[model samples]
Target: MNWKIIFCFTLLSMLETSSSSKIYNVDPSGYVLYCPCMGRFGNQADHFLGSLAFAKALDRTLALPPWVEYRYGEPKSVQVPFTTYFKIEPLESFHKVMPMEDFMEQIAPTVWPPGNRTVFCYMPRGNPDSESCNAKEGNPFGPFWDTFDVDFNRSVFYGPLNYDVIHHNMGDAWRDKYSSEDYPVLAFTGAPASFPVQEENRRLHRYLEWSDDIDQRAEEFIRNALPKGAFIGIHLRNGPDWERACEHIDSTPSLFAAAQCLGYRNEYGRATQEMCLPSRETILQQTRKAIKDYSAKSIFVASDSDHMIDELKKEFKRMNVSVHRMPNPVPQVDLAILGRSNYFIANCISSFSAFAKRERDIKGIPSGFWAFPQKPQNIQNSSSRSDEL
Candidate 1:
């Protein structure tokens, strides 16, 4: 055989061995990339007429795996890629990674010419034979694909994926695997349009769309922060951060304002503060005990009530407990964090308080009274008297 042919045979033989790590949990994944430029001029023209219909990006695409998957491929999870994204990119947003299968068809039903799908990328605009500078720097609009390592024309590690893991990719390290018959239907590299990503759309994209891409990441964080045996996420909506939550709780007249709930009284001759919005004193007492319970790690406060939080902390001088608050001021997605908790502690009156309970009911997570009126009947009677006055 020719020397070149003989050398090729030897390379294949060596590749089959050394790099085989025991593959256990195989995470399936695929791409869903898009950007403001590059998916659809259909050609590199200075005067292309038509709305830059990027949604048409998927017209040439196909379906995805039941669940998308991604390996860390490397350490270090991605931080907010853009600044001011704290608001633009919610904290809990990227922390979750899910299977691609979760979002099958997200296109709203009523849009005209009703054929669309998720993971839609931009259409190709440059010359098929060569990268067109016109496509790179088009007129009033912009380039068709301008969001990658263009500084160095070399291929990018994650931009419009060049290879699938299950499949072959010139024997590259980041190679992906895809079915023999499967291949990428579409790919693009750029920032998507400036249209406001609808609320529901953004939610679907973050938690549902990019989920599989970061599944390993989300799971690891969830596990490290909260081990999976059992947990009860008690949401306290609208409270200030911990320092503020504690300070607000300190101001309440009742030592256990939030604690004087209506459920069965404990050994201290007091009622449990399960779901009712009580005084800050109640929150203080319960917070301290939460530290000692060994039953629970931390309590989730979900309210926007700034004053109530610090007031509640005042009365809890005896117990050592820590409060974990989402760094965000206004949370867009209702906290599903509560349902993940072992049992729940909700405020009696507020709908926000019940968000956790509702999620628990849906997911079949068991929950119990975490707060209530200290004396339901008496409290009602007192309220009635006050009304008469």
Candidate 2:
């Protein structure tokens, strides 16, 4: 009755389907996985936008990392989801994105097991003899990856290359070197984008809208603490650490986040102590000018240290302007309020300031750096690309 032939056909069908079985839970297009373990929230946000652009350029889905936080009481840094502070839809409008927690839960088991995952880096970042990516050796690196129970057993050194993914042929380089068919996930030890952020990616900040909670907190602060009319928002970086850093500004031409304001090529004049840590007088003078220009009725100051709110209050008394700051300040809330201000002034050398500055720039709102443009001629050119980021 041809029973043997029927059995053979059945066996052949089983083998064919087994051969096509999916090895990865993710798509063949692959995923761009990275830790936003660079700096504070502002720096992380900067790197995040660049990473988003990188993923879009490579046509890969980005694993959105949590915002790393180092609070006062916490011994180790806390990992907060990207969605905790910002909405995901705006990021998806640019390209595909998935929260890191989701990727770990749904995809990691099939594509990247704890034993087989490899850490990718631009080049050797650890000891020369070790010649490893050393993905989890440091503070946020260890805490950030550990939060998702991720452990990389091997390292892939990808260079004579840099993360100038916008200008250079970096997408091609990455795709050619690490094909999705072979490597389902390219998990970078750090962000796969340039620091100080690329000028091309500056406009990407517009997509980073705050979550409902963050926006609500900011709105509540504005309604309760600030005056009724338009207000001038200013970010002051005068913490003990910032004060120490500003002391060396004379010797260092290129410092943290200065490239965002001074121009990556220094076309907008080099950074100065005045720009990094403006005096109380300088702050008052600039606040006065901004208030006059925007007809602001109040001032909102966000600072890392004791910003002397009383002194500011006294200085603005004659002008009939009120000064305010949060009782227990939240940086995200501060940034959200800053973005909503009629005018914003921020430090040239601070990444926190850079965050607000970039956001305002995207909204076509006026933004000025503290103690910048010492000469009238130093004003940034309206058409110059250097004016960006």
Clashes of each: 81, 0
Q: Where's the lowest-lDDT run of ten residues in candidate 1?
A: 380-389
Tens digits of per-residue lDDT for model 1, 183-275: 232223333322121112222232222223233333443466553443334544333332333333323212122222221122222322233
**Residue range 10-63, candidate 2, lDDT tens digits:** 455544543223222366688889988777887787788888898887788898
TM-score of predicted structure 2: 0.88
RMSD of 2: 7.3
- Candidate 1 Cα RMSD after full superposition onto the native fold (Å): 18.8
What residue pairs clash in candidate 2, if any at all? none
What residue runs in model 2 are displaced by over 4 Å at the alpha carbon?
1-25, 376-389
Top TM-score prediction, candidate number? 2
Query: Alpha-carbon error at 223 in model 1, in Å?
Result: 4.3
